[model samples]
Structure formats: C-alpha cells, structure tokens
Target: MGKRFENKVVVITGAGGVLCNAFAAAFAEEGAKVALLDINEEAVMQNARMLTEKGCTAKGYKADVLDQESLKQTRERVNADLGTCDILINGAGGNNKRATTDNEFHDFDLPEDTKTFFDLDKSGFEFVFNLNFLGTVIPTQVFAADMMGKKGANIINISSMNAFTPLTKIPAYSGAKAAVSNLTQWLAVYFSKTGIRCNAIAPGFLVSNQNRALLFDADGKPTARTEKILRNTPMGRFGEADELLGGLFFLADEQQSSFVNGVILPIDGGFSAYSGV
Candidate 1:
C-alpha cells in the first residue's frame, strides 16, 4: 500500500523540538519530503540527517520564525529543493519564564514583601508574545504563498490548552495561543477560495524539555501541578508526542479531511472536554 503522504512536501517549523521532530519523522515515514526549519541550525540539521539516514527525503534550514527576511529566504530555498510547500506545521512556539509569575496569584496578606504582577518584566512579556504569536504569523505569511491554489494544501498552527482556559501563571502564553486559535479561524475563511485550509491543534499538557522542570520534580516525579493536570485530564496522564500524529495526518490529507477547516482540534485526551467534575 502507498503511504498517506507519498510524494508530498511538508514543512515543519521548530522541527528540532521533540513534538515537531515526531511530526517530521511520522510524515517522512509516509514518503513526504520534509523541510525541517528551526532557529537552532545544529538541531535541525541533526534531525534532517537522522531522517535521511532512514532513507527519507529531508532537509534542514536555519530560519528564525520571527525574522521575515530569513523566513522568505528559507521558503525560497525550500521551494527550490523540495516542491512548493503543500503542508505547513507552525510548531515553532513556546513560553518564556519572564512572562510567567512564580506564584499563581497575588497574596494580599503579605508584609509588603511578596512577588506580584508588578514584578513581571516588560521584555519578558514582549518576548513571550512575539515568540508565540508573531512566530506563527511570520512563517504563515512566507510559506502559505506556496500553497495558494494547490490541491491538498493545508496549514496547521500549534496552539495550547491554555488558549481555551487560561492557566495559572503564564498569562502571556495563554493570550498569545488564544490569538493563534482566533487567527486559525480568520485565515480559514480568508483563504477559503484558494484551496488552502487553515486549522490548529491545541495540545494539552505534555512533558518536554521546555516544561520538564515545571511538570516534574528534581527526583523525576510528577509535581503538584502535574498531578492537578492529570486529575483534570480525562485520560489521567500526559500525552505522548506520537499521539498527535493521527490528528496531524488527518488535517494534512485533504482526502481525509477536505471539509475540515477553521477548527481547533484539541488533541488533549479529552482535557478540554472535562470540567473537573
């Protein structure tokens, strides 16, 4: 049997990260020529090399999602090497510590010595917003051009569960991902006639290098917050990176989901559906 993405071209940003890397490998295994883009030149190249070793057509590009010039150049190179991008995975976004507060809420009964909202740094807020929001927009602007009028062309933006219900400390990431979700809908309508579908995947709490410290303790055990997450999640555990692959393949394959657009599919193991009842 032929692969689902046989002879297709797919671009994944932040392709070096664990989750995106899983997406890249999954797509490549199905015969897609993968363009792995990441700000970390070494990491992306390493990922590309690993894919190539597996007899997959893959290439790595060093492009900062926040830099329009770099993104345009990278897009041009990708087009020249692989065909016009048919599928784009906007996976290059994360939260910074600066925009996150140490505590969930402000303590009113403190002796004038508690860290509060006033402690939030301006640069931190800007960094988180730009990284998560603009990081997505800039890449979409550069790559979606290749998808215009192309059959089976689609774009998947990566959102977070916090986008639907704001988490405790990371306000900026929540808002930015919410904007991403909203943008996904807007673009779906904006490009309805162009044969390009726009949608988003809101992942629930998943353990990664970015959030391992927050989710696990020094002893490699689940933290209090992690416990809370599992308790609220109907699945009763964190998601594995491979769990997202099925939804990704469905969205990327127009034959499977031709009518699906402007939707945010929460691959959170029912975390979004549960109300902690």
Candidate 2:
C-alpha cells in the first residue's frame, strides 16, 4: 500500500507516554504529520526529535488535556504548522495511586493504612475521572472543529479493558474509562451528520512505563496481578504497544472503515471473553 496517511495531519494527546509515543512514530512513518501533545514537555519533545531525526514530519507540543485553553492554543499551532487535523487520537488518560484502593474488597477493622473505596481521596478520584473523561472531551471540542463537515475526519479514544468489565481496586480508572467508551458512542451519533466517525480501543494489560512497576517486582519477577492477568487471558501474555497500531490504522483510514463507527474495539488477549470457568 502507498502511504496511507500522506500529508495527513494526525494529532495525539498523551504522546509523551510509551503507548502514544509509539502511535506517533507509526503515524509519522505512514507519512502523516504527527503532532505529539503531552503535559511532559521534555518527553514529547524528545519523541518528536527522534521521529524528525528519522526524516518524519513530527512536532511536540506541551499541552494539558484537561485545559481547554491550552488545547485550543495548541490546535492553532498545529493548524498553522501542519494544516488541519484529519485524525485525533485521544490517548491521554491514566490512574492515580490515591484513587486506587489498597485491597480488592473492603473488610471491617482493616488497617488504617489500607485505603478502601470510602477512604479514596476525593481530589484524586476527580483528577483521574476528569483526566480520562474530560481529557477526551476538551481536546475533541478544540481539534474536531477543524474536522467539521470534512470527509475522512475521525476521533479515536483510548479506553481500557476495565471499561467493559470493571477491575478491582481501581474503581476510578475503570469508571472513567467506561465513561470514555460511552462518550465515543455518543460522539459517533452526534457527529454522524458531520462525517466524523468516533470509536474507541480498549487495551488489555500492557507492560508500559506507567504500569511496569505494577506488573513486575524489583527482582524482575511477575507480580501477583500480572500472574492473575495472564491466567485470565487466553493468549497468556501481555500485549505489546505496537500491537494496537493496526486497529488504530484501520479506524483512522476512512476508506477502510468508512462504515465503522460507534465501535469499541477490544485489543485484549480474549480476556473479555473468558469467564474464569
């Protein structure tokens, strides 16, 4: 196939993170002008530098997904630098330690240090929820404006497998991702008339910088949760970040998926299908 995204302007939030950085590189390789947006200025800039070194058109922008003004400003810069946006990947969302409970289930007379759902910090819960949910919304509101009434315009939200089935001890992340999935459907319907397809990919357990510690111990042994995840997954292994690119490419390519919309595609290792029976 020729360059699928030649001259196309693809913008991705959370591009500083491992998964989204890979997405940026893939888009750049496909001849798209990739704009990497992240709050971590240094990280995104380094990623952009690496891609540019490889002769790809890419630039990094320091953007806060929760801040509409910041995104709007970044949108102007992206528009001026690389033309209008053809595809937007809402890849900015994550969990926080404060929002996550210490134990799977609450028990009476638990240790004071043990954080139950009731003990969850309100600020942390709001931060996590807003980051995943509002983070998707604010950016779309700003960037999708350029896509209005334009053919081949689309939005891809990064949801989590927990969105389909809530995981224990991380209620905030699960709930936020679930909301993102729902918003994807809502956006699809809302933008159908405008020719902007909206969809989401709910990733399974992936070992990335953000979750590496959770998956592995200092001794490099699999953690308890990692073992449980593998046991539940039919594929019996965690997914690689690059493994998600195909689904994203399919969704972003208008000709390939013209009729695909409001779909929450799961890139899990059949984890959603298993029942532990």
Candidate 3:
C-alpha cells in the first residue's frame, strides 16, 4: 500500500512456506514484483497463482538453495519474468528430525533407539548444514551479481535464535544458522562498496508449518519443549508471520536502512534478552 518497492523486483526463497509466503504477500502489497522460489514446485506455483489473482505482480520458480546451478537458472528466469532482483530474502532452510537428538540431555540409560549426540549421523548434520548455510551462500552468489551498483539493493538472510546460542536437540541447525549469521556480516562488508546492504533476521520461537510437529503433540497439546520456549521467551507467545514485515520492510527500504548493515535484527519479543534467572 505504501508503494515503497514500486517497480522493484523482490526474490524470496522458501516462498511456499508459512513465513516466506507472508513475506511474499507483504512485498507484493508494497508494490514490488515478487519472484517466489521454492523446492516445492506445486505449492510455489499455487501461491504464485493466488498472488496473480490478487493483481499482484508475482511469479514462482522451482529452486533448491543448495543447488548453485539451479539458482543460476532461477535468476535467469526471474530476470526474464519480473526483471532483476533488487531485494533477496534467503528463507529456505529447516531442521530435519534426523539432525535432531531424540533427547535434550545425555544419560547412559537412555533408550538404544534414541538418537544421542554420540549416535548422531554425519549425513543428517551435513543435510541440515547444507540446507541452511550453503542455501544462503549459493543464492547470494547467483543473485548478488545483479545487485552490484544497483540502487536500493538489499539482501536479507533468515537466521534463528539458535544462531545466537546453541538450542537443545538440534545441534546441526544451530551450527548452520550460526554460519548464516557470520556469513551475513561477511557479505555486508564485502559488498559495502557495491551499494548492496546485507543483514539477517534472527527470529525466536514462532509456530510455522515447518516446526509445528515439534511444537505440538499428537493430540494438539503444546509439547514440553513449547512450554519451555514460551516460559523462556519474555513475550510468552510465539510471533506471527506478519509481525516480521515491519523489520523486513524497514531493512529493505533504502531510505529507512541506508546506514543499517551487517547487523542481525532480532524480532524475538525479547527472548534473547532473558537469562532464565
């Protein structure tokens, strides 16, 4: 409605998911031509169609963030469809159950079937790491080419609370997101002279479709982990997907965030501030 991004092309990875879909709609509402990139071809295309029905300039493409070649191809298609990307949001990443320990603590008497730290699979760690870290790196590599020297170019990476501190049960995701935060700072400095600003959003506990299983039990009651999370979070509630738009829009807008770079903004409702004391 503000038209802050009028005529600008915005690219969002994981565009089919709960959080990223909200991002896509928000950008489109702000008058940006949005390119929704996701590994789920059908879902992404469906989202694209819905946006089209709303008269928003939007399209969807199949992309695997870990696949550099696929990203390059996506860039080409997006350029041809919606023009060059001025804003890039790397939102494709998730924690796999395999990469998560079965229990939060170590005990010798734990069930043999439980996946403890010692029983963690290298492949699982590799999968989660590649999905979160390389996912952001490869897309930036492919798309940042168009952003160089371009006015109002901004790149926003998605980080998690685990990036600031290791979260229990998901070591691989924690490490990978930490890498993402580190890489975000590196890119901001590397592209400082190119007129491109890179930053990240480290979100706290939010109930998205991706992590719903872990947050809720089979009977739909909040799990013990969810209770712990809410107790630790000062806000005592999970963030809604739309709540991220303010920070995102601010960072993406040149007038608003021209001097803001290399910083990881936490929209966590003060979850990071709590010391559990």
Q: Which candidate ranks first by lDDT, i.e. highest?
A: 2
Clashing pairs in 1: none
- Mind giving the per-residue lDDT tens digits that candidate 3 earns over 1-277? 4678999999999998978988999999889999999999999999999999999999999999988988898899999988999999999999888788889989989987888888888999999999999999999999999999999999999998999999999999999999999999999999999999999999888887778998998999999999999999998999988888899998999998899999999999899999998
Please say which candidate is ahead in TM-score: 1 or 3.
3
State how far residue 15 of model 2 sits from its true place (Å).
0.3
Candidate 1, run of 10 with poorest lDDT: 108-117
Q: Please, what are the lDDT tens digits per residue for candidate 2 over residues 136-167?
A: 99999999999988889999999999899999
Residue lDDT tens for model 1, 121-172: 8898899889888998999999998789999999999998998999998988
lDDT of 2 at 121: 93
Estimated TM-score per prediction? 0.97, 0.98, 0.98
Backbone clashes in candidate 3 total 0
Poorly placed runs, candidate 3 (over 4 Å): none
Residue 215 CA displacement from its true place in model 3, Å: 1.3
